[model samples]
Target: MIKDKYTYINREISWLQFNARVLQEAEDESVPLIERLRFLGIFSNNLDEFFKVRYATIKRIEEAGKAARSELGGYAASELLEIITQIVIKQQSESLDILNKIHEKLEDENIYIVKEDQIDESQHSFIKNYFIQHVSPALVTIVLSDQVDLPTLKDSAAYLACNMKLLDGKCQYALIEISRTMDRFVVLPKKDNIDYIIMLDDLLRYCLHDIFSIFEYQDITAHMIKITRDGELDFDSDLSKSFIEKISDSVKHRQIGEPIRFVYDKTIDEETLRYFMDKMSIETNDSVIPGGRYHNRRDYMDFPSLGRTDLLYDKISPLPVKGLSLERSIFSTIANKDYLVYTPFHTFSYIVKFLREAALDPKVKSIKITIYRLAQISHVASSLINAAKNGKKVTVAIELQARFDEQANIDYAEQMVSEGINLLFGVRGLKVHSKMCVIEREEEDSIVRYGFISTGNFNESTAKVYTDFTLLTADQRILKDINKVFNFFETNYKIFRYKHIITSPHYTKSRFFKMIDNEIENVKKGKPAFIKIKLNSISSYMMIDKLYEASRAGVKIQMIIRGLCCLVPGVRGMSENIEIISIIDKFLEHTRMLIFCNNDDPKVFISSADWMTRNIENRVEVTCPIYDNDIKQELMDIFEICWNDNVKARILDETQSNIYKKNDLPKVHSQFDTYDYYLKKLQS
Candidate 1:
């Protein structure tokens, strides 16, 4: 239970709880064995990023001598830092236990994850040959000494710290960086129909003598250590450099950013640990977590399948949208009515098809879209280039500061510029986070507009795993508003009024508040009033307060939040009418949808904005109203499917205990049921 003094959960604490839910998936017996290992990878990866970004921010706040109590959800900056460290240590220990259990289970299935010490004579030749051919060339080793200052470690990169006692009683220290390019899991030749896998770390450990063959040392030992540096990009006021150049420079500087978290193998010698800590100047108050034998467990995300389909989740074929054909003229069909494309269930080809159609269509004159993060080899970028080659005036407003994707976006931006496509770097202050597209086609003596607005990125790779809604429509009202957004991108000084869609940096907060107020008034008038919301996260206290006010006014609110939520629900006389659950399943729950009971008429919206502070007041985001009756109902149906999920959904409350939602109702695995729901729609 929350203390009576506070009305909200700390966002950082809530985020840790969310990661705990992910860890729970790894612990779940029902989850497939290999997939459970992958969940451990995800958990480790999430914690690494949390330390790099969120925890680093709090450290900065504390260093700047600011209490930041309200900003940190009522906890002092120093207090929150200590709390986060304790929670992370506990989680790291739990993850290591889970990893051990998974290894045992894998062994049960005849898949032995062999250690360096367990290498047999038959495997010896293969390991030696593999290291010489593959690992030897890419291996980067640094010799550490008192005379030379230790080089700054790359952020989140794992290293094997070496301590060697020489024959003369003197010691030599060295560091060996784990290569990111090589595969972390090396599959050995199978025998007796049994599979064998060795981790790159253990492989290095086995080859340590070879790595240090030149050193005349009596005894040598290596332990894994990793450093997570602050990830915030800092730009200098250089008047001559372009935005892309500045971002590129800042990204390079991030390699040596202030260290926030230092994770080392618990069994490392005290002398070695102390020497490195003194060299790196890591303060005592900084987050120094003692972990298991291996660091950078994020590599387990790519744990070799080894043809073990039985040990992994069954892969489902992506279904096609009922009436939408990839070969047909998407423009012709969507021009008449809006069609909703929910990804992972519905194929993402519809999005590529829309762009491909716009590229080849002779009548199309211009195309405008917002680009955030694109796939490594994006077909979306190729299609946009093809459109530009066809003489269609293509304007792309790609965000350069999309957080960790700055370099990828910069590369694509330069390529687009060379192709003669007009590019907008977005508004000077705001990040253009809206995912939308508009195409103007000269048809029947009047220009007709067709477009799509999505709650996720236009990247096809993420589209396969992230559940997002894309409304493909030729609704002139909505398209006109989309055009205004592009215009805002080019000329940001003038804020345009959007009649059909709510936009951020100026209108989202107030507009959402007005809608919540309407719900409050409706409940007072004895009209059907409720609010159903699905989002990746909600940290905006302003938005949470509005919901709390509506709840106090007797409005029923059901929320499906996939990540951190600050609002403390189920509190009497405060938020008793509010209930929230987080669903973490096979596909990431990323669709941001809102359904307001506007006197039973219902107002539905699909948005590129979450209820986070940045999405509301800092970034350029869009919340496009769902006007098509069928599409709106389809979204509502999916929301209900997720809300009714009893298997993966975790109830959110003051206690931060991620208890799975269960009941006597028939079992509903929402992710699977959602796929089935679409399949049945096609059958119907």
Candidate 2:
């Protein structure tokens, strides 16, 4: 390892290490079988995105021939690429091992995932009928014979590369696109209390002759292949177009982005692979991963919840916030005092209830919100439309550049616009990622604004599985600054100053640095100096350096980073005072919280931004201080529970080994413990 005084771990490599921890979840036999499979699917999906975005970016930097070592903070882009490739290869092998073990365990449970050759006569008939009815019409096959240019492969979908031997001694290659229109797992007829599952690819393999019976191929072989393309949005610097139009154009351009990686079955023919490599102009330097016959395991995320509810995690009903009812007017409750909504634990319906109340309440004059991503059939959008239809002014700042969801956001924007809602696409050069909603009420000759700020999206569908914090407050000081942020989105040229809110692209980084500096000063004064932060990612080198400085200054630091942490904690004399842990549990830990011991007068903040560079300087984000005593205590309680977690919490050390926290105390699983903690609160 290269050692330098100020240098730290490379962010990309650290991200791979974080993903390894996720893969470890699959290897843990104590987890439920289906949950373990879902973890593997998550690992696969995460790696696909890492290749598409981070790996692709580094590849571009390497290709540009610039000295990216300094830009990356320690290692060159070329070196990082090699490191990533090695780490990913190891993790992929581990994933296969875990999958084999899971398969064995599944057999013990009387469920079998069978291949094409293992099918019985009954299964054969069932699969044949299933394929012809469901999979055949959606299958698009292309014959490769040097007469046609290679087809443009989709990044999100997988293809079956077929090698066929005809009766005339001629060899041919063909492609079969896996149909996303159909489910990836096909459940077969049960025999003798034994359940059987077959991959959609194998089902296609079983019926391949029927699919190509008209072509008269005697021998055939099908291998799965998947391509990952660069997902960067390339927007033209055209002055005539609006920002929304540029984002739309960039979204379209992303469909044909350069291929970054090609993953194929290990048993694929060398000749066919070479033909594909030559046609696609893919050099050996590009990632060409060899794997099992099935690719795109992300589809397993939807793996047929299949009436086997007993085999999955018991569904927990999201509880209502204590003393906050959906039937009553949400505005009236907020008008009385500030409230907090902890999601997945507390129902996300309060947000919807707030909007619904605004839609019908005559005293409410206007509603405004900044939306990053909304659900497919969003009640949020419906409520906004209802407000607009009821003659209440509704303004929505909808981000049309939420990656992979750009089309959905664009559709929502158009629908809202047609419904007389004042829809603002987003800022010119920045994504509006902050989740904030404001309702202006015409109460007693003065307009009062009531709303909430969150650390996650306004998406109700995701709220069930994502752990996030949302604060509902009628505090005018914070809402006034929120209004300023909306104004910044509208005007784009006005320079707004905020005192109570930390707005990004201008204030987030500097303000956070100042907070760290304050902690450093407190340490020097012999006062209680400590900092606790919880975020999704901590990849920004500058922020990491600030924390390192604080660690050197004798200020205790505790971090609960759920993903992509670049700082290596517990290094003697470098970061000995700092401890870092990551929790991967049932719900995605998405809340961003920061607590600083300002000489025992603690300051707590809930933010929509992580410590990553993208969140601090490139996107629009907000970090609001928690002022209410009850809410501050609630946030602290949740953070402390996560911090004390020995189960499911992994230490982030320099080795990137993802070692679980070991102690002699009784086991405490944070996610379940947190749910019970809130349940007790409701009872009391």
Candidate 3:
């Protein structure tokens, strides 16, 4: 085990490395073309959030002092900040190269991403009319020289930094916020079987002269720029206002949060950049990222499908569970045995079907659920409302502080309350992060509870792209404890105990450490000992140290983490037994699974928590055991497949270089293989 003073990599830097793997997907020639483009969008979107949250927090620490570095674990905040900036700059350059290659490939298929100068006469007229009819009303232009306070710039909105040269040989600047209310891509009329699409920015650039014609400007130039602000919200402990009002005020505060980044076109004049920065009070070190002609590459996530089905991968229909049907009562089937639903591979509708049945069943008495993130148009909320309308007591614990999702959750809470459902606005200080639902129904003489515990959110829209596992069971002990969690949410003063479930802010961290200790003891006894964990991240120093102890005790460790793994694997004598690989492919690996070799009688758990500090000590999370024989074997099989993947898996090492695992054996893409594995099970 090679142990040094620096025992772990910084979490923020590790996260950036994970995103580089996503960029690799865009560069891989074997990937489907359109899928590659979408990966680029995913990479860009991930970076945006990293800046808004993680980077912003680190910058704050840097400004505080060197004393804050001790609290950050090992690396100084200033040092980490410099590393992140350098790494992001390199990744951005790589992304530009990948984009150029993708464009060349697109031209081979007769598809073109054109700018304003490339548009023909017919396309020009089409874009002009389209802009006037659809985009004009939403456009708001601020004349920069005359504004009292530079209009509060939005977090992710793109803007055009207009520089107008008047007939008097004087220069002035104006700002136009891109109309996100309208589509960002405008498809033009195809000519000679070639398809052309223009960006929203370019379309505006084409009509710049027309927009400022009233001002008698001789020369007009518009360059794209975007500002990313710190999204953290500060709430006052007034005691007079309700939680709802506090959250609303926080949302308003988010709009005016300090600017953390100012990205603009490099081609813009120095005077223009300085003008905007001065008004926003932005310092030089505050991420003044200069880029291409367009900003907000995240808009590419909605790039038009173009109706060229051949250019994209065929959409796979979510398969039905082998024995469960939508028409049947889900509770009765779950009562027979535990069943697992693997989403996108297995239909997410099974969850909805279970709730719907409970709503209309005459014997059902009450329903309790905890929602952290929800779909925009949620069927889950609708089912709860229907149950409430049917006279069943329904209670919902909604986390109104879910980042970027506060507004939607507040809306759902209000609507659910109006429908006579009992609504709880989470715990006072901790955000409830568990994805669980319980329904109580009377059977003969006793009330029986049936529910689902999941490793992901209840949002159906994300279920299609995020690979997760939901276990539907009628286990008495687990459901009884789930009820306790819901009770804790409703009555914050009350404390609850659990024998089977591991819950955060109380027992989760201690429980996991105990499990790791057991593995260490088993290894000391000269018995078979191994640990396997699959999660989104692993950054908590305490947990990392525990894993290191187990590694030194001769316990073999295998990890399949999809994002932000701070522990350096494969270090001699220190972590030589630990092998870590991350897979970034068609679907996000979001399921949190942990397996321990309990002297050959293995133990497995599916959890909503990762091994991060926030999940263990700051948030409310749940981790449940897999007891059913069939389900345990299924999870083991999935984990093994992911661990063996060489195609998309990247090694996590000390240098933080994201290198794909290479072998001479036949290539195995775990996602495609997992799909095939499930399909075969259905056939059997």
Candidate 4:
């Protein structure tokens, strides 16, 4: 157990601070204008998910009358909910201010984002025609009343709460659902080199007359309001339904789940707000946030570029990995030596190439892979289907519970099943979070195995923007362990021992603890001892305590966590030897890596798991040790580059201030520098 004096930050509160860093990117004038707007959208989207998942979870605990102090890092569930609401309110207000400033900047660049009243003659005809032809058919308008039962509002759907004052003393209230199928941003015809854009909310306000023409109202008003429902899937006890059917039913039921968050425009009139609140049965304890004019500002992520490339960050071409050729046979190459592919810096086509080769090679008799998420247009899925058609035994273990991507995974699973590919839903009560593929081939009168392990999903779309690593090898030892994992998926009753890779829920914590103990022993023996790690988040108390123990033993520790770091770094006698930083930049820092100095002979690993309890104890994750000396050096070099980043890196200290790492040395933008590093290696 971690001592109370160790000082752990609440995960929810730390996540809010991470979003605050996103808001900082939006407010940063040094960033490109259009990219800054997208950052604002990203900030809003992150908050929406936080409420739906984290905040909803806490609300459930409060309703259950559980303090949950220990689970929540010492704060009671009710207390944490109040703190989250207050922090979110401040963030929302700051985001609105940032949006206003961005709008002013856009105006300076001859890009005017106009309101309903700002529509001029040049855009008037276009708006009317566009609405009649495109939006009118898609619109869902409900005329609400007290006499009739209110319809259950769609979760997270933006609605214009319409208040109409009739000629008589009575009033009519209606809600117009914004058509999600249509573009949230509508661009108007340019006039004299000046570009004009308007949000869909303003467009709806302008067309209110056309919508409610029969109401005979003297005046009408519309303000945006949105509700976020609890997103946790509650399974049914139906025995007859298949696993897929149960999951599908749960996803459908999510729409009517209890409300956890309600956001509305502060400018909205009191009568309308109260009426809707009462009708929706919103309680005072619910997260009722007063927001800006727009509710779903996440739509700003898709704000049209308008062909102004100058106003956006310049796109960099993904580089080719050294010694890896997409045109060559990946199996033949990996048989010789293990190679690492770092994505976004390097093109993701190598992964696709590997799968395609496995599909066509006649000697390749079988393929096994674990998938968490796939791209919408997944070449990886197509390749697997192709392998199945070519008489290869292809077995896929696809996770259907990848949050927010569940429906997409379900659709892909059905398609794969139809194509004659064997699908496994993974072991009961354990999520298959590992990203790995193993294949067997007939080689010179004997069977040989080849495979790849990754720190991310094999999704091509995300691979373009998420920094991840994939290691390809033909090592028999590692491939044997990979095969054993697939067997466990098939027959989970028998727990198997793995000699090479670390598997979660059975071995990850113990293995890591042993490794840390080795480092501590080396420190005591007067040898160089240090630990370096990179992960998206770390919150497990046992893991944090182990690091504290190592720190107290005089072993230096450095961490680069992208989000949700709960351990209080730099606390004397607790984590005095520990320092942490987080990098928020163009590409998400998603790779999980660990390095330990065992008497100067370093041991390095890349994993799918973070230090969170779910990953360590509930999910089936894999941590693969880097055996190739070259790849080990490459990983260490990249970590050092990121550690020394003066730009985009924020020191994650006790204050949670998100201060940038700055020094007198020449600026090192790690993302750009890493790309250059790979480019130079390719040239060499």
Candidate 5:
């Protein structure tokens, strides 16, 4: 049973495996060509954040001489860091290969990504004029010397390391910060009905002669270099400063955070690389990654369509839930039966409609909501503000520390605070990650509570690509628990007990464990017993151990996990009853659901929390039970739809091989099939 002395794969490594699935999409020629390029971009973006957050954390632990194995799952922190570096280097190399193949394929479609040398005479004038008109003034170039101190390189932006060799046996180094304000992929004037585009990096390379006209140099070479810094924001314990002020300062200071990883082109000159490491005090043990000619591939996410509809996935108009009406009162509909709004398949306007109705309704006494992340132009914030202006008591618990969205939330936080709305900055030592809203409406007989809980944020932007579930219910039992969670936010010193919804930082772990224990007990009693779960990630060792115990008790477990799963299933006698599969498809699988068999009576829940320890014990999260039988059946149906997906599902076993869960049975692409499912549901 001792397989390599460890039952689970490292979470970081499992995370990389998950990313590799994204990369696999890029490699699959069956996918649209332009979509493949964007997949490469997503892969790059995910890697950048991984290094910034996860890798940076392990580096700090290693630096403090506390590189313990237990803290990092199994390997010591130093060893884990080395392993991560090696894996990233390999993945970077593979990404370059996939990119080159995609470029070749793009040419077959009459779309070309030409390099600096590859541009023809017809495109020369347009390129030069475009550069002089657009690129010259925006450029920031710094000449390097021993006397002059190097400017702190931005972690998010990419830079070109310029090496110049002068006539009199001397060499000089310079840095050119790539302007993120400009587009990375520049579409040149179309010629002969053929689309031609050049990257911003190559455009600058083409204009290097013009850029260095002032300085006399024999030769100059530019190569891409990028650095990622620790993304964790440390707040000051200043009693005088408000929570917003502390968070604002922390976000500002994140720009100059310590470097966690340094990436340079493999062909970069040793002299320039050495000069950079020496000047920046980059140690040998630091993540020194070498990659291809270009970095910051994330900009590819916005790759120009070039009007080629044939080269992209066909856009699907979001389907409307049958019973939920957008034009009428959302509360009136929810008061009867609970409705589930599945995004990318179902329209997100229902959530907006619910809030807007609450905002305008004269009977609505008050609204309380918890916000984690919102879009740039958020309808959610505007609705909440409108409610405040309408004289309704609106209390907002906006988490100011929502990672990269901190500043955006802070801006809205200040605006909401100024707009006569009651704002709770955050709970001390707890980041409120729950997505919940409860509104009190004064009916003729009594005050009624109508609320919603979601497995995703209320942001309208992310709803397009991210698949999440938002449950709209008028069940007072559940809304009572939601209101308690909100009340506990204000009075955090006092603990609140909930009967319907399982909350984190106090009850999620114990309550969920009890669910698992029930299944285990039922299995021992020869009753029907099984568990099904859907999650973005699950790395909780305690949760894993409990599931293993259930598996040993012959309680069947099936998981549709989209991201980082450290649990190794399919091991004989240990996890034989547990089977896990991950689906990486056209849309991000972001739904979190859990189901347990209670003597053939199924109990199901939709949650805002994953099984990750942070979501369970460190943050404020919520899991609401499905009391409405119709909604419960819907959850079961969708989970089975996702589970039965053979086209995108990858088996999550001890090997971490990510093999497709394929058989002779008909192939089921869940994303498309899900939309069809909703379509049939609407018809039925």
Candidate 6:
């Protein structure tokens, strides 16, 4: 297959479309008003990260003189960058319009988002006092002048650019950092059963004179400007430094990474905008986005609900897995048969219960786990520490380079060390992106292994909103492979073989390629052959080519990819047998699962990997095969439920239009139906 014939979407363009789906949620009328607003916030937040990581990467590629067009899925880096900028500018404008529409609808419900100028006499005292107490001390305001270079602007932080005209006709400029310590949305005192809210931005706008009373300004204007810098950490060649030390230094340096994007209020004066462009050194190729008055709209994600249950999605109590019990030993349940825990549908407490049980279980001799990102207040860390406190040997391979989570993981690593838990900073070049845990327990006459593997982080906070699968099993074949992974962390020189679980940086690519080839061969013999995959992304060209090979051989392929799928599906002769859909709704579609119809007998696996080159060859990831027949059926059923969803699922095609899969059949809102599927199983 020549590079020219390989048809795949540019990952950057695909990612922008994924975010547009998020924006679609904000635009969807059926979504609860509060959730739609929060979706807009999520959309904004997702864009920030994209600019920092993906967009920044493409900028570097363009600077390196265009050698990686094949790698970028046939689009030139410079061309892709321009296309991304134009798409974002258009989305940013649409987001502003959507926000306005939401606000108007909010007013229909007597929930007014009153600006500083819109605030009446009834709200003045509250706003003034709120500003004095909450906003004043937390604020970081800087005055700007031509004589001084701008303070190293923090990446992804929103700042208000002020253009003040003094009584003497002298112009002064300033930048005010929005207080992260305070809520961006301030709820004012209620009047006549009507609620009024003011954004911190507008509150600051109202108090401009008070903020600069000493300046004697005749006029003042402020507009939001947010700059995103490259988030890639560049470690120095300091050999003697500890991994933690290196990570700390790199995080500090990340604040000063070259700017990849500069977003400002579209209505800001040309003079102010140009001053920002020149002073900030925003490059000609760097994305210059014209956003609304509110730049860091990610804050809208936490827009206070104002005690309005009617305006929010109905909360469902997380149900328990049919047979797994928090009261009983989780090991005992897994010891019987493999049990899968689908989170948001099933309670996250099972994971905590398992760890806490291990902490207290006398038979449990040792515990080994992998940590990526943890909740701010993590019970998982506490449970592991408890096990260490109880004289059980606890080993943790915490990835210190978990992107934006480096500092948090470092802090937890220090705390775990203080608690006497052995810590591994991951292998030198490969990040430990795999999520698995194995506990060795003293059974009658022999030691037995019990473990769980997950498709997402073990953070309970995210568990509530992100849909993921965690499989609990005492199967020796899978447990042995998991133990080998932990063993490799301690002894990086050894190359271990696996029979049941597929591991990365060694076997994932070859194993998956072999699987795809098997399907293609099976189809050649005129047997039933098909592939089903669910994942967060699939941008790997090698993996894409293999899939195209399978598709060409008439093996049907169905995919539920949540984000950044570069494969150009439904193309004649290239990928006609493949169809992919992405679902974005109340809960993020986060499970990474694969099923293969091998000569009518199915093979199933759940994975902690996307088909990205990073996951396949650059990181330590694990893909565990499902051995238990019942659990395999359960996984298949869940996949079918998502695949059949007409409400939230959107077709992924050559156009990248993100049109929802519409049908006249009885509506299947997959997430809701999935929960009910488990509920019905419990009753039966």
lDDT values of the candidates? 0.93, 0.87, 0.87, 0.93, 0.91, 0.92
The TM-scores, one per candidate, come to 0.99, 0.97, 0.98, 0.99, 0.98, 0.98
Q: What's model 1's lDDT at 290?
A: 97
TM-score between model 2 and native: 0.97
What residue runs in model 2 are displaced by over 4 Å at the alpha carbon?
A: 1-6, 237-242
Report the C-alpha lDDT of model 6 over 200-230, residue by residue, as the tens digit.
Answer: 9999999988898889888899999988999
Clashes of 2: 0
- Tens digits of per-residue lDDT for model 4, 1-684: 533324898899999999999999999898999999999999999998998899999989999998678889888888888999999999999999999999999999999999999998878999999999989999999998989777999889999999999999688999999878999999999989999998888999999999999889899999999999999999999999988888888888889999999999999999999988998899766899999999888888898999999989889998877787887889989999999999988889988899899999999999999999999999999999999999999999999888888899999999999999999999889999999999999999999999999999999999988999999999999999999999999999999999999999899999999999999999999999999999999999999989989999999999999999999999999899999999999888999999999888999999999999999999999999999999999999999999999999999988999999999999899999998898889788
- How far residue 73's Cα lies from its native spot in candidate 6, in Å, is 1.9
Looking at candidate 4, the ten consecutive residues that score lowest on lDDT are: 1-10
Write model 2 residue lDDT over 35-99, tens digit each, in one string. 88998999999998899899999989999988867567578888878878888888887888888
Model 6 weakest 10-residue run by lDDT: 1-10
Compared with the true structure, what per-residue lDDT tens digits does model 1 show for residues 1-684?
A: 322226888899999999999999999989999999988999999998899899999999999999678888878889999999999999999999999999999989999999999999999999999999999999999998889999889999999999999999998999999989999999999999989999898999999999999999999899999999999999999999988899999999999999999999999989999988998998777899999999999888889989889988888888988888887999988877889998988889999999999999999999999999999999999999999999999999999999999999999999999998999988887899999999999998999999999999998999988999999999999999999999988778898999999999899988999999999999999999999999999988889988889989999999999999999888898899999999998788899999998998989999999999999888999999998898888888999999999999999998889999999999999999999999999999
Candidate 4 residue 298 C-alpha distance from true site, Å: 1.3
After superposing candidate 3 on the true structure, give the runs of residues whose Cα lies further than 4 Å from its correct spot.
1-5
Model 4 segments more than 4 A misplaced: 1-6
TM-score of 6: 0.98
Clashing pairs in 5: none
lDDT of 3 by residue, 520-629 (tens): 99999998999999999998878888898889888999999899987878788778889898999888999999999999999999999999988998888999999998
Q: Candidate 2: lDDT over CA atoms?
A: 0.87
Candidate 5 residue-wise lDDT, 1-684, digit = tens: 221226777889999999999999999888999999999999999999999899988888888988467657778888888888898998999999999999999989989999999989999999999998899989998988989998998877899888888877688888889999998888998888889999999999999888777767899999998889999998888999988899899998888999998888989878888888898889877899999999999988999999999999999999888888887788988899899999979899999889999999999999999999999999999999999999999999999999899999999998998999999865788889999999999998798999999999999999999999999999999998899998998899999999899999899889988989999888888899999999999988888888988999999999999999888898887789999999998999999999998988899999999999899888999998999888889889999999999888999888888898998888888889889998999899
Put the candidates in lDDT order, highest first: 4, 1, 6, 5, 3, 2
What is the lDDT, from 0 to 100, of the residue 383 in candidate 4? 98
